[model samples]
Target: MSHQAIYRKFRPKIFDDVLGQEHVTKTLKNQILSDNIAHAYLFSGIRGTGKTSTAKIFARAVNCTNSHDGNPCNECEICKSILDETNMDVIEMDAASNNGVEDIRELRDKVKFLPVKSKYKVYIIDEVHMLSKGAFNALLKTLEEPPEHLLFILATTEPQKIPATILSRCQRFDLKRIKSSVIVENMEKICQEINVKYDEKALKLIAANSEGAMRDALSILDRCVSFNNEEVDYETVINLLGTVNYQVVMEAASSLMDKSIEKTMILVDDILNSGKELSFFLDELIICFRNMLIIKTTNSTDNLMRVSEDEAEALKNASSKISVDEIVNYIEDLSTAQLECKRSLNPRVLLETKLIKMLHGVNHTDIETLTKRIEELENIIKSGNVPVARQSAKAAPSRQTAVHNDFPAQETRKTVVSEHAVKQETSHDTSNSVQEPRNFENKSDEAIFNAIINGWQAILKKVRSENAGLQAIIRESKLTEVVNKKAVFEFDPKFTFHINAANQPKNRQKFKDVISSFVNDNCEVEFISKREKEEKSNKPKQTIEDIYEDLKNEFGEEIVEFKQED
Candidate 1:
C-alpha cells in the first residue's frame, strides 16, 4: 500500500482521540451515553479544528453495537464497516461539490429508506455552508423533522453562510482552535510512535506556525521528517517555513527604536533577499511589538502563548527602552500596514514605508503626538539648553523687540529660542517683502512669523476649545509667513477643502480672533496650498547666508548666533 499522509493516518476514531475539543466531545458523548440523540447536528469551527472528524466520531458512536461510555468500539463490525467506508448506511458527502438543489433533493428522497446494516442511517455532509439557497430550502423540512431511523450530521468552517432555517433545526457545536501546547504534545506522541528523533523546540515552532490547526502542524512535521528522516530541528522548520528569526525581528525593532533608518532598511532588504515573505516578516514584527506591549503593561509573560522564558526576558529587556505609548502606536501602524500588505503588489515597499514613518514618529494631529511634542520641549527646557533673553530699562518696551536685546541686567523677560526654531521662520523675497515701517506696536515679520510658529499649538488648542471643526481644517496647515499683517498658512495641495472652509467668513473670523489673541495683533488670516505658494513666489529661493543676513539686520549679531549640534 502507498504511504498515507500523517494527518489521515492519525485521524481520530473516538471521542477520546480528538484533542483540544473537550467541550464539544464531552457534550456529544453525554448525549450518546444517556440514549438521547438529536436528529440533526451541526459542528462548526475554523479549518483543521476537528469539525468533520467530530461529526464522523459522533456518527459512529451513535450506531456502534458495542459502545463503551459513549465511545465507539472500533472492534465492532458496524464501527469497522463505517471506519472502512464500506457501510452503506453511513453515507459521507461533500456539499462543496454537490451543492445544487437536486443533490439535496436526492438526499431527502433517500432519508425514507431503512438502514442496510447499522441501527440508524447516518448522513454526514462536510462544508455544508457551500450549499445553495435553494438546496438549503430543499433540505430544511427533512432536517427539521427527520425519520426516526435516520440522522443528519453537518460540518462547516463557516457557519454564518448557512441559512437560519437550517441552523435552527439542528443542535449546534462550535469547535475551538487547538492550542499550541496540545498540538506539541500530540506531535511528540506521533514522533515517539514513529521512532523519529526530534527537538522539543522544533515541535513548538511547528505548532506556532500552524496557527492552532492540527492538520497544518502534522503536515509541516511530515515535510520536516521527509527532509531529514532523522532529527527535526528548529532551524530546519524555520528554513522550511521561510519565517523570520526572532533575533532578526529583535534587531530590526532595536534599529527602529534607535531611529536608525539605514539599519532598518538594510535589514529589511536582507530578509527579502534571503527569500522570506515580506508579509510573514511583517506579521512577526507586529507580533513582536504586541508581545512587548503585553509584557510592558501586565508585567508578566503569563499571557503570552508561544514565547518561552528566555524570549520573554529578552522582550522585557527590549520593552524597557521604549514607552508603552510608543509600543501602542507601533502596533497600530503595523497592523494597518499588515492589512495593506495583503493587497499590495509591492509589499516590501509598503513595509519599508510604514517602518520609516514609525521611525520618524510621523503620525500627526493625534493627541499622543501632540503630547509627545510637548514632552520633548519640556525635556529641552529642563536640560537648561533653552536660552532665556534678558532686558534692561534702556530696552524697547515691545516683547518681540525685547527678545533680541542683549542686556547686562539679570532680569529675564522673554525666551530667545535657538536658531532651529528661528530658521523655521523663512525669509520672504525682497520683492514681495512688506515695506511697513517698524514701530513699537507692529512687530517685524521675522518676529511675528516666529511667534506664529512657536505658538501655533496653543492657538490650535484655543480654537479647538471654541470650535473643533476650525481646528481640524487648520491642523495640517503650516503658518509659513506673516506678511503685511496677513498670516499665510500653507497646506498640502491635496486638501482643497481646507482652503475653502478656512476662508469662510465665520470660520475665518473665529480663527483670526484666536491668532489675534495669540500674537497680540489684529492680523488677517489667509490659507493657500504649498503649490500655490510656490507659484506666487517665482523668484529663486533665498540661501542660508541670505537668511542669515536678513536675521542679522532684524536682530543684532550677538543674538543672531548659529550653533549646530553634532
Candidate 2:
C-alpha cells in the first residue's frame, strides 16, 4: 500500500459530501429525484470549491440502478465501478490538454456510439474554458443537441472565457467559496476520524489561511501532520505556513494604537527573523483591524465566525482606546500598505513608515477636521476666550487692585480635540497662513489679479471644504483676468463641458460666497473656454451707447438715452 494525501483520501463520494456548495448540490439532487435532469450541465466557481467532485458524484448517481433518494448508494455495482474509475460509460477529459480541434472532432465521433453497459454515457471535461475557438465551434452542435443517452458536464474556474453561445445552451450552476468556520468544522471532523491530535486554534489558522477552499485546508493539514507526525499545535501551524498567530496580531495592534514604535519594530523584527512572509503579516494585520472594527461597530456577533473568545475580548478592550472611524481609517491605510509592500524594494522600511503615520493619525478626513479645529482655536485666541485668574477681594484692604484682578475678564470656550488633529494641521505649511481679507471693489485690476493668483490655493481649499467633488473639475483651472469686477475664468479647450457645469447658478453662488470672504463684496464669476477668450480678445470693445441701444431694443424707448443730460 502507498501513502495517499489527506485531500485525495477524503474526496467527496456523493453530492452530500461536498461542503460550501449546498445551493448547487441541493438543486442537482432535486433534479435527479424528479427525473428532470438536463442533458448538458455547467459548473463554475473558484478553484477547489468542488466543481469536478460534484460532476463525478452526479455522474455516479445518474447511472446507479439502486440509487436511494437521488444519492448513489456507493454499495451498488455501477456506483462502485464509477467510484473506482473502471466504468467505460463515464469518461473524464482534461480540456486544458485536449483543446485542439482534432481532439474535439474525435470526441464528436465517439458521441455517436451508445453506452455499452450503464444507462447513460457521461463525459466530464475539466477546465473547459481552455478550449480553443475552433474546438468550441466543433462541440457547439453536439452540446446543443446531444443524443438521449448522452450527458455532458463541463467545469471551469473561469466561465467568462466560455462563449455565451455555449453558456446559454447549458444549465449553469454557480458555486460559492466555503466559509472559514465551515472549513474549520470539516477539518476537525477529519482530524478526529484520522486519530490525529490537533489544537482547535491551529485548525482555525489553517482554515483562515486556506482562503475558503476545503481542499486547500486539507492540503495544509497534511503538511502540518507530516511536520509533527502525531500532534499538530498552534506553533507548528504558524511556523510551517509562515503565518502570524492571533497573539502577535493583538499585541502588534496594541503597540501601534499606543504609539509605541520601538516595541512595534521589535515585534516586526522578531516575525521577519522567524522567516514569516511580510505579505502574510500585512494581511493578518488587515484582518485584525477588520475584526476589531466589526466588534466595535456591530451590536451582535452572529454573522462573525472563526474568531475565538479570547481574541474577541482582546479586540473589545482595544476598541475602547480608538474610535470606529479611526479603526476604519487604519484598515484602509493597511490595505494600501499591503499593496505598497508587495511592490516595494524594502518592505520593512515601508511598513515602519506606515506605522509612524498611523501614530500621527493620517487619512482623508483628518485634513478637513484639522481645518475646522484651527478655525476654532483662532476664534478663541482673538476673543480672549480663556480662563481668567482668580481674585481675592476680602483678604486685605489694598489701595490698588492686584495685577491679576486689574486684567480684563476672560470668557471660557470649551473645545475638545485630540492632539493628532493639531499635528495634522501643523503638517501642512499653508494651513497656518491665514490671509487678510481685502476689499476688491475699489482696488485696481492688477491688484485683483494678484489677489486671485496669489490666493488661489487658499480659495481652492475653501471650495474643497464646500464640496469635495468640485476639486477634480477645478484642478487645472486658473484665474486669467479680472474684467469689469466680474472674475473671468479661462479653462482649457478639453474642459469645455466643465466650464458650463461650474458656471451653474448654484455652484456659481457657492463660488461667489467663497470669493466674497476674500474680497468683502459679492463676486460675480464667468467661465469661458480658451478659444472663446482668445476670440473675444481679437474683437473690439463696444461703447456705453451701444450697450444702451441693445437694452432699448428689448425694453422699448423709455429705457434708452443716446445724449447726455447737459
Which number leads on lDDT?
A: 1
Computed on alpha carbons, the lDDT of every model, listed in order, comes to: 0.78, 0.75
Top candidate on TM-score is 1
**Off by more than 4 A, model 1:** 1-4, 299-304, 364-566
Alpha carbon lDDT at 305, candidate 2: 44
CA-only RMSD, every prediction? 15.5, 20.6
Q: Find the 10 residues in a row with the least total lDDT in model 2.
A: 388-397
**lDDT at 317 for candidate 2?**
87
Model 2 lDDT tens row, 1-566: 12338899889988889998999989998988998878889999888889999999999999999888788889899999988889999999999999999999999999889998898899999999999999999989798779999999999999999999999989999988898888888988888988899898888888878778888888889899888878878899988888888889888888888778788889989988888899888888888888888888787753564566677788888888887766777888888888999999999988887776566442334434334444654454355432221111111113112322443241111122111111111222222334455654665444566677888888889889887767566655778666434577889989977887787656666676677676655455777888988886556323222233233232322322222211
Residues 286-332, model 1: lDDT tens digits:
88898898887775466355765566677889999988778887789
Considering only N, C-alpha and C atoms within 3 Å, which residue pairs clash in candidate 2?
Answer: none
TM-score for all models, in order of appearance:
0.68, 0.65
